[model samples]
Target: MTPTQRHRVLALTPYARLLSVWQTLGIHTDHRCVRGPDTGMAMVRGRMGGSGNAFNLGEMTVTRASVVLEDGSLGHGWVAGRNKPQAELIALIDACARQQAWARRIDSELVEPLAEALEEERQQASQAAAATRVDFFTMVRGE
Candidate 1:
């Protein structure tokens, strides 16, 4: 997958799940964090009806980290929340994803499962919403 898609999956995958997958893969690589797993607030904005004037949604907690692998590949992770370890691990994984030696394994082992799980969750939510949908019909009045 492209880097954008890879990063999106990394951001969405839960810390626990990602950690489990990492352990299961049994990967050990040397890396150093160059930036923080620092927590801060980011302003969220939204558009009314998806196209109307934009308005502030509010601020959300964000944690970001950056890492460089031994092979000199760099990665950055930005996730919503205050989970520092999760942010660091995401950065490491992102670095691995950029490396030629690790890219295939990272994609197949880590990213694919996470993406599938995300898609499954999306499908379930859609089904739930569909169940609550209402249909309306009106009859024309006689002239």
Candidate 2:
């Protein structure tokens, strides 16, 4: 897969699902973290009304990690929470997924299932939101 595809897969997956998948695989890996899973606030910038001037929205908590697998593949993981263990696991998975031996299994077993689950969750949320939407219209008055 292309680097963009790999990134998209990782970004879309929830940390909980990632953990579950890793546990299910039961793969023994020896790796070390090159960077911390430290939590910090990241400044969020946004444009007003979707196309207006950019401004700082606020800061959000984020955790990032970097891990190098035994095969020397370096993987980086960043998530939107202060979950250090989750970040570490994600980094490990990222490294493992890049290996030729583990690539196929990781993609098929972890990425695919997680992607499907995420999509289903999004669909359900969209449906629920749509059900609550209200449309207002002007009623014509006969004179």
Model 1 error, position 113 (Å): 1.3
- TM-scores, all candidates, are 0.89, 0.85
Global local distance difference test of model 1 = 0.90
Candidate 1: tens digits of C-alpha lDDT, residues 19-81: 999889888989999899799999999999989999999999999999988777889989999
**Predicted structure 2: lDDT:** 0.83
Least well predicted 10-residue stretch by lDDT in candidate 1: 93-102
Deviating ranges (above 4 Å) for candidate 1: 136-143
Candidate maximizing lDDT: 1
Clashes of 2: 0
Task: State which candidate has the highest TM-score.
Answer: 1
lDDT of 2 by residue, 66-111 (tens): 9998778898888787989877888888888888898888888877
Candidate 1, residue 53: Cα displacement in angstroms equals 4.0
The number of clashing residue pairs in model 1 is 0
In every candidate, how many clashes are there? 0, 0
